[model samples]
Target: MLLLLPVLPTPEFWITLGNYVGLYSIVAIGLVLLTGVGGMTSFGQAAFVGLGAYSTAYLTTQFGLSPWFCLLVGLVITMASAYV
Candidate 1:
C-alpha cells in the first residue's frame, strides 16, 4: 500500500491528505493514551486545541501580532491552562 502512493497523479493532494491524517493520528494517539494509560475520561483535548486556536486568533486579529508571536502566546496560554 505504501509503495503505490507514488503512482497517484495528484501528489499534492496526497500530501495534503497525509498531513491531515497525520495530525488526526496524533490527536487520536493522545486521546488513547489519556483514556487507556492515564485512566482519564474526558474531552479535554478538544478544549485545549480550541483554547490554543482562539488564543492565536485573538492575538493575531486584535493585536496584529506576527504569526510566530501568536503561536508562542497561544502555546504559553495553553501550557499555563494545563498547569492550572
Candidate 2:
C-alpha cells in the first residue's frame, strides 16, 4: 500500500511529490495559525515559505552543502525574514 508507492514512481517523482507535500503542509499550518487563531488573512506566510525553499535550494546547489544543513539554514533564514 503506502510502502509500494515509492517503488511504483521514479525517484524524481517521489522527491518532487515529497517537496510539494511538505511545502503545502507548512503553508496549511501557517494559514491555520494566522487565520483560525489570529483571525487574519495574509499572504506573507507564502512569502516566508518561498524564502525557506529558495534558501534551501540556493545553499544546496551553490555550495554543495548537505540537504539537512541547508534545510536548517533555510528555516533560520525564513524565521529571520519573517521577524524583519
Candidate 3:
C-alpha cells in the first residue's frame, strides 16, 4: 500500500533533497546549541551567516585567496565576531 502511493522521486531528486536536508540539519543544530546549551538567545544567526559569506567574498574577490583558505579565514572571523 505504501509503495503504491505515487512511486517516489528519482535518485537525483532524493540526492538533492538529502543534500539540502544535511545542510539545514547542521545549521539547526548550531542554532540549537547556541540557544539550548549556550543559553544565548540570538536572533542574529542570519547576520552571522551573512558576515561570514561577505568575508569570504571579500577575501576571494579582493585578496585572490584560494577558496578553501578563504573559507577558513571566514570561519575564524565569524567565531571571533561571535565571541566578541
Candidate 4:
C-alpha cells in the first residue's frame, strides 16, 4: 500500500533528467581517473571544471563548433594543460 505523488514529470522533464545523468556519469568517471587509480589529490577540481566551461564557451562563441567537437577539443586541452 504505497501512495503515489500527485504531480509527475512530463516528457520534457524526463529528457532533461536523462541528459543530466549522462553528463554526471562522465564527470564521475573523470573523478575516478583523477583520484582512484591516478591517486591525484585535488585542490583544484573547480579549476578543472572551469576549464571545461571555458572550452564550451570558446567553441560555441568563437568557433561555432558542434558540441561533440567542442567536447573533444576540451578533452585534449585539459590533458595537455595537466601535463604541462
Candidate 5:
C-alpha cells in the first residue's frame, strides 16, 4: 500500500495524503514516547494538540500574526500548559 502512494493520479492528492501521513506519524511518535518511555497514559494528547491548534488559529485569524510567530506562541503555550 505504501509503495502505491506515488502512483496516485493527482499530484495534489499525493501532497495532501503525504501531509496527513506525516502529521499522523508525529502524533503516533509522541504517543509512543509518552506511553512507552514515560510509562504514562496520555489520553490528553489530542487535547493538547487541539489547544495548540486553536492558539495558532486565533493568533493568525484575530491578530494577523505571521505563521512563524503563531507557531512559536503555540509551542510556548502548549509546553507551559503541559509543564503546569
Candidate 6:
C-alpha cells in the first residue's frame, strides 16, 4: 500500500479491504469466544454484523440520515432481532 502512494491516485480499495478485514477479525473473536468457551458453533455474530450493516446502509442512503443516528438505529435493530 505504501509503495502505491505515489503511483496511484488513492488507495481506496486497500482502505476498504482493511475495513472488511477488521470486521471479519471481530467475527473470528466472537466465534472463538462462543465455540471455545461454550462448546457450540453458531453464525450469530456474522448475522448480526450483516443486519446492522444493511440497516445502517439503507437508512443513511435512502433517508440521508446522520451516521451516528443510523448507528443507534442499527444497534437497536440488531439487539431487537437478537432478543427475539
Q: How would you encode candidate 5's per-residue C-alpha lDDT over 1-84 as one tens digit per residue?
A: 767767867578778888789868988899989999999997899899888878988999999889679978998999999999
By TM-score, the best candidate is 2
Backbone clash numbers for all candidates listed: 0, 0, 0, 0, 0, 0
Instruction: Candidate 4: list runs displaced more than 4 Å.
Output: 1-13, 32-40
Q: Considering TM-score, where higher is better, how would the candidates rank from best to worst?
A: 2, 5, 6, 4, 1, 3
Which scores greater on TM-score, model 1 or model 6? 6
Q: Could you tell me which 10 consecutive residues in candidate 2 have the lowest summed lDDT?
A: 5-14
Give the per-residue lDDT digits (tens) of candidate 4, residues 9-39: 4478766787789878877887899899899
- Candidate lDDT scores, in order, read 0.86, 0.89, 0.85, 0.77, 0.87, 0.87
Error of 4 at 36 (Å): 5.9
Any runs in candidate 3 off by more than 4 Å, and if so which? Answer: 1-25, 32-41
Candidate with maximal lDDT: 2
Q: Please tell me which model should have the higher TM-score, number 1 or number 3.
A: 1
Q: How well does candidate 5 match the true structure in TM-score terms?
A: 0.66
The CA-based lDDT of model 1 is what?
Answer: 0.86
Put the candidates in lDDT order, highest first: 2, 5, 6, 1, 3, 4
Residue 5's lDDT in candidate 1: 76
* Ranking 3 against 6 by lDDT, winner: 6
**Tens-place lDDT digits, model 6, residues 4-75:** 765867678877787789868977787888899988978777799899989999999999999779989999
Model 4: worst 10 consecutive residues (lDDT sum): 1-10
The estimated TM-scores of all candidates read 0.58, 0.72, 0.56, 0.61, 0.66, 0.64
Q: Give per-residue CA lDDT, model 3, range 1-84, as digits (tens).
A: 546534765577766786679758977898989999999988799788888879998999998999779978998999999999
Stretches of candidate 2 above 4 Å error?
1-16
